[model samples]
Target: DVKVTQSSRYLVKRTGEKVFLECVQDMDHENMFWYRQDPGLGLRLIYFSYDVKMKEKGDIPEGYSVSREKKERFSLILESASTNQTSMYLCASSLQGHEAFFGQGTRLTVV
Candidate 1:
């Protein structure tokens, strides 16, 4: 089964602290993505990596960044967590956009 697993199911943090979220996939997919979802806002891409050591800033990558030093793992970093950044973070992997699998999601509440 193609699966993506997130490091956390829930995270609570105060404003102005750095946060790290990890993700792993067993499919060896070349494309991995990080997205934040909110009610009625749909999924907004934060960052994506096409291959190891290569990354791209997605639509909503203002306060977020990513790392992909290993093919099966990707990490998302929030430089300064804020209440406005609270949302469900989802990790996804796909090969050429054909049927992407998502992690369970991490619900982050920045207070």
Candidate 2:
């Protein structure tokens, strides 16, 4: 069975600090994405990577970045944390036209 796992289920950081959120997939999916979920905003894309070292900026890329050094690992990076960045971050993996598998989600709090 395919599975997506997140490094942390909950995280807390202070303003101006750097944060790293990690996700891994057991199935080798070609597409990996990073999204942030807020109260009303729903899931907003932060980054999408299709191949190793290849990335595309999503809807809300500001203050965030991503890395896909390997096929199974995708990482979300917060350049500098801020209060406004507090949200639940999700990671997903899929093959084109296939159903995406999501991680449990990482709830991040920026103070």
Candidate 3:
């Protein structure tokens, strides 16, 4: 079975704090992605890696960065948390042209 896991299901941070969110996939997928879901804006991509050490900025990457040092793991970094950055973060993985599997999202609240 395809499995994706997020490091946390809930997070709370103060403004200006740096936050790290981690994800792992056991399915050996070639693509991993990070996205944030907001009330009105829907899910917006943050970053994606198609291979280890290679990353592509997605629709929204202003306050975030990503790392994929190993094939089964991906990490998302929030440089400086802000109230506006509060949202649900999701991690996903998929083989090329295949259906993606998603992790249970992390709900972040920046105070």
Candidate 4:
């Protein structure tokens, strides 16, 4: 089975602090995505990488950036964590379709 691993299950941070969330996938999938899932706003894409060293901005990339230095690893960096940025961050991998294999998720809380 394909597996995605997140660095942490929960994280708490103060406003204006930098945050880093890491994700690694075992599958050799071509696409890796970072999304923030809120109560009603649904999953908002933050960033995605189709290949190593190549990245693309998603729907909501203002407060976030991403890194894809290897085929199996991806990272999401919050330049400055804010209260509004507190949400469930999810990492996903897929070949091309809308269907994706998702990680358990990382719950981030910014105070």
Candidate 5:
């Protein structure tokens, strides 16, 4: 079974702080994605990587960045965290044209 692991289940940070959310997948998939979920906006992609050392910006890449230095690991960085950036962040991994396995998610609150 494929498993996605998130470093934290919840996070709290002060405004203007830098934050890092880490994720890892056991399935050795080539594609990994980072998304932020909000009430009305649903799941909005923040970034994705198809291969190690390669990354692409997704729909809502503003204020977000991603790194995929290893095949099974992907990291999301919030350059400068803010109150409006508070949301549930999800990490997912999958093969091309396949359904993704998602992590338990990290709920972030900025104060």
Candidate 6:
């Protein structure tokens, strides 16, 4: 079974702080994605990479960046975290055009 692991399950940070969220996938999937989930707004894609060292910006990329130097790892960076940025972050991995396997998710709170 494919498994996606997140570095942390919960995090709390002060406003204007820098934050880093890491994700790793055991499967040799070619596609990896980072998404932020909010109550009513649903899941909004932040970034994605289809190949090692190749990345694409998703729907919401402001104040966020991603690194995919390795095939099985993807990292999301918040340049300067803010209160509005507090949300659940999800990492997913999948083969091209196939169903994606998601991590348990990391909940971030900015005060």
1-111 in candidate 3: lDDT tens per residue?
A: 779999999999999999999999999999999999998988899999999999999998999999999999999999999999999999999999999999999999999
- TM-score for all predictions? 0.97, 0.97, 0.98, 0.95, 0.97, 0.97
Which consecutive 10 residues in model 4 have the weakest lDDT in total? 92-101
Error of 6 at 93 (Å): 0.4
lDDT by residue (1-111, candidate 5, tens digit) is: 779999999999999999999999999899999999999988999999999999999999999888888999999999899999999999999999999999999999999
RMSD of each: 0.8, 0.7, 0.6, 1.1, 0.7, 0.7
Between the candidate structures 2 and 5, which one is better when assessed by lDDT?
A: 5
The C-alpha stretches of model 1 lying farther than 4 A from their native spots are none
Candidate 2: stretches off by over 4 Å: none
The lDDT for every candidate, in the order shown, is 0.95, 0.95, 0.96, 0.94, 0.95, 0.96
- Tens-digit lDDT track of model 1 for 8-86: 9999999999999999999989999999999999999999999999999899999888889999999999999988999
Candidate 4 vs candidate 5: the TM-score winner is: 5
Give the alpha carbon lDDT tens digit for every residue of 1-111 in model 6: 669999999999999898999999999999999999999999999999999999999999999999998999999999899999999999999999999999999999999
On a 0 to 100 scale, what is the lDDT of residue 97 in model 4?
71
lDDT of 2 by residue, 1-111 (tens): 789999999999999999999999988899999999998889999999998899999999999989999999999999899999999999999998899999999999999
TM-score of candidate 3 to 2 decimals: 0.98
Model 5 residue 19 CA deviation (Å) reads 0.2
lDDT of 4 by residue, 14-111 (tens): 99999999999998888999999999899999999998998999999998989999989999999999999999999998886757899999999999
Give the clash count for model 4.
0
